[model samples]
Target: MKNRIQKLTAIKNAKKVDAFLITSLASLKYLSGYFFYFEHGLSPFQLLPAALVVGVEQQASLVLADNETQQLAFIDPSISVKTYESYVYQKPIDHTTQFLLQLGEAFKQAGIKSGRLGVELNALPASLAFFLTAQYPAIELVDISAEIAHLRIIKDEDEIASIRRAANLSDIGQAAVLRLAKTGMSELELFNLVRREIEESVGTRVPLMADFVSGTATATGGGLPTSKIINDGDLILTDFTPCLNGYWGDSCSTIVMGTPTMEQRSVFNLVKEALEIGIHSIQPGVQAREVDFAMRQHLQAKGNFGHHGGHGVGVIYHEEPRITPYNTMALQPGMVIALEPAVYSADYGIRLEHLVAVTNDGCEVLTKFNHCFQQGI
Candidate 1:
């Protein structure tokens, strides 16, 4: 978390900004080192609008609603916490006005009165951005979105540990479904059951879902679970991503309802091979696209491939250094990635995904689930 603040300061120094604001919830949580969502069930997209502000010579500050003042004080008593007029009592327009007014004051308190300031323009609301410029004509607001992305790409040790914990929780959920999901159960039932199991397994509640699919629908990246029932000779694909302590863990596996047809087995084999090929290409300094091309070539030659070979997974489910034909960023140690090489067809699809970390000479798989058709436990 200190590195997060230090990185933003480094960016501020490089850009010659006296102060910077962090609007993205992910960035705030990363820097604040507090799990804001653990006790609150709200999604980040609809969170209690909050921001973290830092100045060159001042302590970091938190801007949020007044009602959350006590909680934030209890969590971070030392840092400055500024709050707007109560949003609960004010009209929507007034709320926005007061919020912006308070935000402007926070900027001033951070010593941005007549200096360049940085904000995550892409993530900050357009109207709010306009209000900021209008109210603080003395401060130059620059978009530091790229710098924020760069800062988040390479995870620190704490982040890596949280991601691993999230992954373990995800595996617990998927394993429950695989072991107990029977032919007669509906898709939604399996999802609900596994979700409960995941919730019970974690020390803190984490968001969980199963891309539960069977029969023909498993051929694609399935959506939410439905009423469809598992049947004989059908394959079930379950991909679960559980968010824990602000970090997400991803895991996917294909389970058999009965015996797989020879042709179906062939498709699974090829997909497994593609995943292996993609993983084999991962190492410090390897080009991202090179790994993607190596795996995609196998599926492309055989036909019916969709989706990127892999993507970075950390505070956000999908991040940079994407393993795609268009990205050329070199892999670096400390990056945790999910390599998912899938094959989609008209009838159904088979794919495999596992989380891994880029190491000095190679990549280490973070998840250990039963991907074996005959011996998976």
Candidate 2:
């Protein structure tokens, strides 16, 4: 934790900022160790109350609603914590107003009254941006979103452990799909059953994203679960991404309900080979685009696959170090990425994905699940 603050402090001189006001949920969780409830559909107003203030001269601090004081336990003891009241019926001022007022105190206490402040221009709320400029007319706010994102691209030990746990949960979901999916089951039923199995493993509700499609639907690339029925000889493509412990896990597999035809087996083998080729290309100092090119070149003769080869996975499901034809970012140790190779047609489609962590010499495949159809065995 101290090292992260020092690294941010090192950037202050170059960016010409005295302190940083971290508003993005990912940044806050990464720097302060406080995992904010960042579920989707929450209004921006609800997200305005959390911030992490780190100054070059003074101590680091966190600002949040008083109701969230318990989060202090998770934060470093060296950093100060400030809070405002929340969930009150008869308050002298509204919640946003109180939050802004308390935030001003946090900034002032951090010795950020003047000079420049590094802010996440993309993630900061318009209201908060206005408040900062209006309150401190002398202070200049610089956009440091890109720098922060670059720092998060590399997973520290703590982050790697969290992702490993999340990946295990993903494996659990895939197992459920393989063990429970049967002929005549609706897509939605199988999706629900898989979700239930994941949540049961974690002992709590988990935020999940998925592509649950079967038969002809898989040919469309991917989609949400529907009432489509699974039948004998139909292929089921299951791509599940479950967020647990503030980290995300991604896994995908395609299985046939009954015995597969020669054509189905051929396409599945081609895609599986493409995925293996992509994984083998992952090594330290390798360019991300090279990985994409290798996989795309292997499947070009088939002419049925399109989409990125893979992408970095951490706090965000799909982030930097993108494995596309255009990206030139080099793969490094501690980088966790998901690579998916697919073949789509009007009749059926097959996609196989694996989550891997770049190692000093090679890569470690985090996903452990069988890649076979039920009846093929």
Candidate 3:
């Protein structure tokens, strides 16, 4: 937590920001180590579930609803917690007025009268922006959401541990799905099997999402599981998501319902090779685009392949430092990345993904799962 604070301070200082108003929930947690579920009526946006105001001088305060304040205390005890009453409750205090008063008090206490105030415009609502500008007309509001996100791109030891556990659970769910996959199994059945296995294995209600599609549907790559049944020679693509400890581990594997055709095997081999190339490119000081290029070049050398290669995985499934041709962010040690290489065609599609930890010399694969395309019982 101390290191997180220091990293934020460094970002603030580098941007010459006096204070940063963080609205993104992940950013809030990264800074204050607090977690709160977003209430729809209060804050519907995932990006700005709650607001966190942190000053360059080491002052930090969190603005949340009354119901969430106590929950946040369990995770972060140092942050000054201020809560506003719920809008549905009819009491002496009203929700809007309570939030306004709390924000005013927090601003005043932080001595943020007139200076360069940074806010995550991408995450913040326009109405909130107008209200803040109206309240503090003298302060200069600046958008520094990218700076805060870049700071969180690198994972710490604890974060890596949490993601590793998530990956392990995801592998378990994938194995369950594999066992249920057969020539006549419905996509929905496979989905429920994996979901039930994850819940029973963890002994808790875990957030699980998976896409089990067959034949032509497989080309779509990702979608909610349906009742579509598998057929012999049909390709099955399953992308697994098992959320644990407020983080997510995402992995996708392509399998054949029965025996694979020669063409299908060729496509799967190419995708697997592309994934390997991308994984080999993970190391400190390597440009993010270099990995994307490596994978794309592999596919282009064979033929045109569909979809972007992969992306960063953390609190949200798709975070920063996206693996695409457009992004030039350099790979750094301590960054957790998901390498997914996929190919789509009219008849079938195949994708193989693995969660990797970027290290100083090379990369470490965090997810443990067999990539075989054999049919399951």
Candidate 4:
């Protein structure tokens, strides 16, 4: 875990702002040790605390609802916590006004009256934005959401370890899918089988997403499993995501239900070659788009391909430093990316994906799942 003070200092240096108001759950968890209930279980809507205020000087303050005060305190006992009962009306006595007033007082106490106040506009609610602006008219509000995202792009030791565990879980799920895949099995059935194995192996239910499809339905390339059934000589593609400790791992592989046709084998080999080219292209200082170009060029030469070649994976399955033609950011050490190269056709489709970590010299493949096209039940 990164020290809250170190994160705040990085934010201050990057954005040149006096302080940042973090409203994003992921960002809040990254800075503070608080892991909210919503992140662990299902809920109608995510309950977000008002805001976590971090100043350039390492000062920390949490503005939360009355119900969350104790929970936040347990997460960080030494931090200053302020509570408001904005929506908690069941209590005989409410501290809503007190919370907002204390928050304003904290700002005043910190001497942050007339400098740049960074806000996460993408994640900040409109109502909260209105209240902050109304309360602090002298402060200049700046959108620093991208600056925070930049901080999360590179993986630290702990973050990488979490992702590695996620990758191992995903590999287990893929192996289960490969073992159960057979002719006459519906895509949904195969998907559920993999889900069951993953939960059983982990000893608890976690967030696991699997997509299994074959034949013309495979034209979609990637999506949730449907009711379509597998048939002889059909190409089955399974893309899996397994989450561990708020981190994610993504990998995809194409399989043949029975015997693969010569045409299917040809397309699968082309995709495998393209994937190899893309993986070999990954290294520190290499442009992200160049990898996409190499994979796309290989597929286009073969006369079959898809739109996006690959993407970055982490806290969010799909995040920054996207592997597309539009991205120009250079790859750096500690960056983890998901590289997928696919070739789709009217009859069948083929795709192979792996999680890779960018190193000081080159890149290392993190996923060890089998990608054999000849493998069967």
Q: What are the runs in model 1 whose C-alpha is more than 4 Å off?
A: 1-3, 34-48, 67-78, 85-94, 374-377
Provide the RMSD of all predictions against the true structure, rounded to 1 decimal: 3.2, 2.0, 2.8, 3.4
lDDT per model vs. reference:
0.76, 0.83, 0.76, 0.76
- Per-residue lDDT tens digits for candidate 2, residues 1-377, read 33367668656767878889998878887787776665655534344648888865757888888777767776767778878766665755466887887788877778888888899998898988898889899888999998888888988877877888888888998888888998889999999999999999989889888999999988987899999888888889989888865678898999988788888888888888888999999999999999998888888877847788888888789998899999999999999999998888778888999999999988988887767766436
Name the runs in model 3 displaced over 4 angstroms: 1-3, 36-48, 87-93
Q: Which of the numbered candidates is closest to the native, going by highest lDDT?
A: 2
Best by TM-score: 2
After the best TM-score superposition of candidate 3, give how far the Cα of residue 44 lies from its true spot, in angstroms: 7.3
TM-score of candidate 3 on Cα atoms, chains taken together: 0.89
Residues forming the 10-long window of minimal summed lDDT in candidate 2: 40-49
For TM-score, candidate 3 versus 4, the one ahead is: 3
What's the residue-level lDDT of 21 in candidate 1?
Answer: 77
Q: The CA-based lDDT of model 4 is what?
A: 0.76
Clashing pairs counted in every model: 3, 0, 0, 1
Q: Please, what are the lDDT tens digits per residue for candidate 3 over residues 1-377? A: 33366676676678788887777767776777665443223352222346777765767777777656556644556678777665454445455556667777777767787788988887787877888888888788888877877777889887888789889887887787668777677888777777888788889777766777878888877688788887888887888877774677988898887788888888788888888999988888888888988998887855556566778887777886788888888888888998888888776778899999898899889898878777542
* Shift in Å, residue 302, candidate 1: 2.7
Which of candidates 2 and 4 reaches a greater lDDT? Answer: 2
